[model samples]
Target: MASYRGAPYIAEQLQSILKELGANDEVVIVDDASPDNTIEVIRSITDPRIRLIESPQNRGYVRSFEAAVAASRGEYIFLSDQDDVWIPGRVAAMVVALESARVVASNFEMLGGGPRPWIPRLLPAWDRKPIANLLGVMIGYRAYYGCGMAFRRDMVPVFTPIPSYVHESHDLWLAICGNLSRSITHLEKSTLLRRLHDSNETPAGFRSLGRIIAARVMLARLILEARRRLKR
Candidate 1:
């Protein structure tokens, strides 16, 4: 999990996740030097499974999640946002899916009737089409949110060093690696309650044509990079 100024809601989110985790399961969180009491709230949780890493400086969530992934010791890695609540079966569902696939992406619903998503929810049939999945990601259709995704530990090298130019959409970069390798699985159920608000890093609104084109170019470059890494 990547945490910023999440003091207002992180405690509730952590409570939701902690219940689902076992004694051996772990939650790795990297706090990006939040100015708020985010760090304090995390420490108050008192769970041995919760591992919090404090960043010396604010490096944005991309690098924070990267650092958290690096420090994680689990064979299965789950990405999470600090303020969202995980559903009861999320860990079990995604872990079961990951047994056969390198990566798994799931659907999500709005929390407390938060703003509705602009794109359509993901369907189970979509998992079978790798080409379509790649194109969906390229055009910004597939909802490959980090909060709803999980991957195997072996994919760490493939997903990280997250393309120097990618300041955002690290989850999309992971989706690209999964799809490029044709090893992604789509879960039909909503795994978590996504809490979308103004502070959310992912833009909920549409992008300008220029920004859209730039994102496409970035996705293309990510595909090439992922292909090269997989070849090695």
Candidate 2:
């Protein structure tokens, strides 16, 4: 988990993750210099499976994720935000789904103690697509949230240390890899209760048309780079 100033909900998130962890499983929380009590709350949880690492400087969400996942020793890695509530069976369900695939994504509900409806206006994404089609789907619309994503360590070569200029974070890279493997699976059950609030890094919807277009262009560049890396 990569966190920044998540004091209010970090404790709850930690508790939920800890409950689902198995005897051999471990939870690693990497703090990106939150400038808040998020670290304190994480330390308060006295679980041997839970390990906390503090970065010397704040590197934003993308770098934080890279750092956390790189340090983890798990064969499979689950990424979560600092402020969401995950339901039970998340780890087990994903593990089962991943048995025959390289990666798996679960459904999640948007929340913040109320209902808010708004999606990106520029491009509509497919619920499911072939690995070849996933690049376009991701460029046009959002599919996986960081919290709802999990991948095997074998994917580290492609997903990690995400290119510096990509428009988004590692989530997109992971999605691209999932599609490339032609084994992406989506669980219909909602295991994540995603809380939306003022502090969210991403807004509920597109903020401007120019921003959207710029994002698409950046994503196009990312796809080009990915092809070169994948030798496609």
Q: Runs in model 2 with CA error above 4 Å? A: 111-128, 131-139
- In model 1, which range of ten residues has the least summed lDDT? 113-122
User: What global local distance difference test value does model 2 have?
Assistant: 0.75
Can you give the TM-score per candidate against the true fold? 0.96, 0.88
lDDT of each: 0.90, 0.75
What root-mean-square deviation over C-alphas does model 2 reach?
3.3
Candidate 2 vs. true structure, TM-score: 0.88
State the weakest 10-residue window (summed lDDT) of model 2: 118-127
Candidate 2 at residue 62, lDDT? 84
Residue 22 lDDT (model 1):
88
Among the numbered candidates, top lDDT falls to 1
- After superposition, the stretches of candidate 1 with alpha carbons farther than 4 Å from their true spots are none
Report the C-alpha lDDT of model 2 over 115-215, residue by residue, as the tens digit. Answer: 42343321113225654356555555445667888888877777766888753556767776676666677677677789877898654664598977776
